[model samples]
Target: MEFAADVFPGGPSDPSVLTQYADHVAGSVWTGEERLELKLSSHGKKVHSLGRSVPAIEGLVIGTRLSPLIACSVDTGDQGLLSSFVERWHRETSSFHLPVGDVMITLDDVSSLLHLPMVGDLHVFQPLHMDDAVQMLVDLLMVSAEAARAETGQCRGLYVRLQWVRDIYKRRCHAGHWTAASREYLLHLLGCTLFANKSATNVHVVFLEALRDLRYVVHGISYTT
Candidate 1:
């Protein structure tokens, strides 16, 4: 299939916009002094996504205020930020070692391709909120996963999607940005979405690498146990 000729046409090409998009997608908006002082715990607020209720695991909040994912501005030509996010996402989704057909996808490239079309130029100047970013990423992953499946039915697109989300949560934990509560919430969000969205597919080997290698069952199939 021929990819879009101009993946990011009229997209957020400005340094500030690019930085904000990257930060939101990478969950780096919660890192600065203006960051909220979240009082998260293993038990926390419930968040709804993909048609299920999930706690805001590893989320940052203050009192009754909590932001799941936020955006921040990055300096011009900050390829390092883009590179780091790509590396982390690649490592999490098994893209680094495994070849998904002839496609060697980089997060920076994939994101530019996947992210801009849906958002268009509306979000050029303003950074995307947490929900918008996740929604966009989810949409992009689903679309990309379908493309990958078309190219190579050798792998489950759902797995790739789940892994992408899983890796985001793991990166947040690694960055020390997420609290125990936030981690739990994010994991639950991912797990719930996986079960709800892709339950029809038979998943005999769903690995929750960040969740201490545990496993669970849904519809007679195994997942992040």
Candidate 2:
């Protein structure tokens, strides 16, 4: 099945949640025993020494910018699997405005840190779909802003993403890599949503607006294409 179908076969109209998607993906490929063996085979002695561990567990998290979305745990000693989960989680949630806390991926003493990249342009790691790519970047900034404010209770650090976005916008405009429609969409997002000034606490508002606009653009592209 296609990635979207595997994750959301019901299509955009469906009310399926992210938890269900995570569960399905984690459970579908391998049985509990098989998953354990696979992890051991891959990691060897290091896997066995990761302290108390469990089989496999998966979770999904979703929430708006106001609150913590989902809090779940997985009990696996396999560091590799934990890393993969963190990477997958970043890919899936890179379009939202919420700042995700650490997702515990093990039941034992084993643990891994999942930190979203903070310094570079997120577009560098984006997939080929321009619409999704832009949305991912917008979301990353939103999350970074939230994290920064949550840590320091100030949004001034968000200026980094804002600055990077401005640089990217300028470069993209000069390169003419975007279609007229894409250009227009991005211009509106940058002009009306992101670059607009707002109070520090309301910084998430910019990201929310950008996200809403990106959703429309993606929908339009899907329908017309």
List the RMSD of every prediction in angstroms.
Answer: 20.6, 20.3
What tens-digit string does per-residue lDDT give for candidate 2 at 1-225?
Answer: 123454344322233434444443344443332343333212212212221111111110011111010111124677775545633452233322124643433312111121211221222111233334334444533333334344333333322233333344345445653332233223323222223333312222223233334323322211100
* Number of colliding residue pairs in model 2: 1
Runs with alpha carbons beyond 4 Å of true place in candidate 2: 1-135, 138-161, 179-215, 218-225
lDDT of 2 at 26: 45
The TM-score measured for candidate 1 stands at: 0.20
Q: Please estimate how well model 1 matches the true structure, expressed as its whole-model Cα lDDT.
A: 0.32
lDDT of 1 by residue, 120-152 (tens): 221112344434433333343222434434322
Worst 10 residues of 1 by lDDT: 213-222
Residue 139 accuracy (lDDT) in model 1? 41
Looking at model 2, residue 123 earns an lDDT score of 23
For model 2 the TM-score comes to 0.20
Residue pairs with backbone atoms closer than 3 Å in model 2 (clashes): 75-107
